[model samples]
Target: MPVLVATVIGLTLIGTTARDVVSVNPEIATAATVFCGIFVQALPFLVLGVVVSGAVATFVTPDRLARWLPRRPATAILTAGVGGATLPGCECGSVPIARRLFGDGTVGAAALTFMLAAPAINPVVLIATAVAFPGEPLMVLARCIASLLTAISMGALWAKFGQPRWITRNLLRPTQQQDSRFSTFTEAARHDFLQAASFLVVGAAAAAALHVLVPSWMFDHLAGQLLLGILVLAALAVVLALCSEADAFVAASLSMLPLVPRLVFLVVGPAIDIKLFAMQAGMFGRAFAIRFAPATLVVATTVATGVGLLILGAR
Candidate 1:
């Protein structure tokens, strides 16, 4: 209700002020449109993410998942990374599920893999990538492969050298120990959906604002420069903090950079971004999120660069 009222007042002010001004205030108009568009675009995804996340939290038990997996960390991580292909939601929804998995004693490599893969390799993200880069089946394939490799590699690295102390201290608690009425699938699903959706809305709104306010020419300076383009896009991804589901659309629209650079945009988004980092820090602890986010960023950028080169050569 407040948002609606604000929108009406804003529009009225803009309408009234336009006539009096010698020239229209493009910046103000652009800012308002961008802000509103972002809110609208992100609401649905945010709602969906929260519902799914809440459901997973409520229904899926730590013990149940543990029984379904092997004791080996490597095997568990592989399974978790690939399992993302089966999940339906975007990156925003994955954080809660990953946290839940960690809480359920599915920590270490497996939990990290789930965090990366669930957002990047999920069915929804893949389909969106395919649609975004038409006539380029390879783009989707590369994205999936790059994302999976990055997740798996990072998981393995963490398992080998990472100190247990660095892992999210909060997840050290036993999730199975918690008592809740979320035993039923319906209850778990509902809870997961709501939790994930709230974050998704926040992310999508930010991304939409970037889409409207940031001009395409801003990227023109980096066109055809892969390294600079990667850095710039990665920086933008951090600032925009867009959900994995909708980021491809924004990337596709950029059209200013080369295909490889655009690929980097999608790859870097899920693993490390400002919003995700903030959420992770808050939920997992500052120390854990800080280390994990930077590590993921470096690994994702390297893998994405390799994939980009491969695709460019093949073409």
Candidate 2:
């Protein structure tokens, strides 16, 4: 294929360029490692998500998911938020699944809730938060409550105001003619992987550049300023585009800031970030992603701040 040939040529050029660049600027080498690390850490989850989403596309009808959920819209959204706990994976896998589940009307809200909640409220993420902030279990509790609240709020918003037109018709459409179920699943998985993974490369490149360019002194100056700290860390979370399973460790490493910003980091990273935005744009559409991502960011940050002050302050 043309893409395959172009990629091979690009990589060959990069292999030659990397040797020269590393000799000139060592930071480029370090950034490359971080770039590769992000992709390597995310690929398995991406594959899992595509497979899960493919299965959902092939087997789970809209009526089936609708039947499984509560009849009331608000209850269904909340249930979906809670249901996110069942899927133990990072944000990378949740996007495609969300797209697959997004049917017309209220069911779309539940799917979106699950997309946001699964990465943040899942046991693996909570355990990582606990380990990251030892003796401060409040951090874990705050993260869960804040992330769940954000998911629920977004679901509610979508139920009230969402225009299905924002999402591409391709997302809601299934293949009319079925081959074998296995064949359908494989085709869906392969298509999703290619789309999601290609965008992930863009996100990973942005993250690597930000990782290298962000000055360490910036954190030193953020002490005692809660609002500024929250904003900066939220922005950093978006830029770093870290895997939800691992972002807590990175947040913990930033001991310079207060618990609130770190809490904001955990809350915002899983809910809205560069990588998730890219995936959403690919799966849904640019219109949906642009509106949804900023809303999620504001909700996550606000909810995390409120929860952090309550739980962490009480302790």
Candidate 3:
């Protein structure tokens, strides 16, 4: 029956004109392309993340991670934010790595910090920001400062109010397991990819829909107002669900908006967007994401606004 259906579908495709269908409703085709682009772009990074996560599961223990970090949560969170530069990937990659590194107490806080900071502060993203806003070196600086501040704030907040019970997913445990090392690695990677990828599809679809639905005139009008621009762009960041590595260009394209609001968009997108929110909610829990995401948006926006004013001189 499946084979017959497949054959019929293949015949129908051969008989039908795809171009005519697209000509009738281009939005559907455009949305599909956008969705695929997002999914494809994140695939490599997601794979790398899960592989690293698997390696951590197989080799690195919580006690080892705990011993490597500072004794105090505050200090460790700061350190993690700084150390985020070492990971050369986007937010999609950091989620699994952070999950692998997450532990009880200070380690968890540090891991959360690293997760928020890594994609935003990494050299690739910084260079992209610099390139996007040429002659505006301060934009790059503002982005770095705001992103680090946001990351550190979230880490500190998590240390104070985040409860482990809120996280539904647990890190893979190598001990008390019967599987071979290679098998364990493969399993972990497979599980992380499937889970993250599924939610990623949902986010990508939503983003594509927004791209098609929202009018360009709406942005032009909103960009004229300072507070409204910042808030709208911040919300746009969440809605667009752009990859951190590429978001600078997207923010830069919003030339109608002032530097400060665009800066807020860049800062807010990587720290907490639709895609990252979905991934975090899956890895953490709805309870945690509900609290954490809003706080991140607030902190990121405030920090970006302040840093932008100081650096860009009210521009």
Model 3 worst lDDT window (10 residues): 57-66
CA-lDDT, candidates in order: 0.69, 0.79, 0.76
What stretches of model 3 exceed 4 Å from their correct place? 1-66, 174-220
Residue 116's lDDT within candidate 3 is 91
For model 1, state the Cα shift of residue 259 in Å. Answer: 1.3
Name the runs in model 1 displaced over 4 angstroms: 1-58, 89-93, 103-107, 171-218, 312-315
Candidate 2 deviant stretches above 4 angstroms: 1-64, 172-217
lDDT per residue as tens, model 2, 1-315: 479679979989799776887768878887787677767755665666666656656785544655778768888898889988865545766777677778776789998998999878887677767876887888888899999999999999999999999986375466676589989778777776676567557657765665678676765668667889889989988887766765666676566678888899889988998879988999999999999999999999999889988888622
| Lowest summed lDDT window (length 10), candidate 2 | 169-178
Give per-residue CA lDDT, model 1, range 1-315, as digits (tens).
Answer: 466468779979797566445146665555455544545554554455445544554555444655655667878988888876765545555665566566333365687787788788876677767766777788898889889999898888877766666555464455465455555545545544444444445554554455566676766667746688888877777766766766676676566577777788889988888878887887677888888888888899889889978875422
Ten contiguous residues with the weakest lDDT in model 1: 191-200
Q: How many clashes in each structure?
A: 24, 0, 0
lDDT for 203 in candidate 1 is 52
RMSD of each: 5.0, 5.1, 5.7
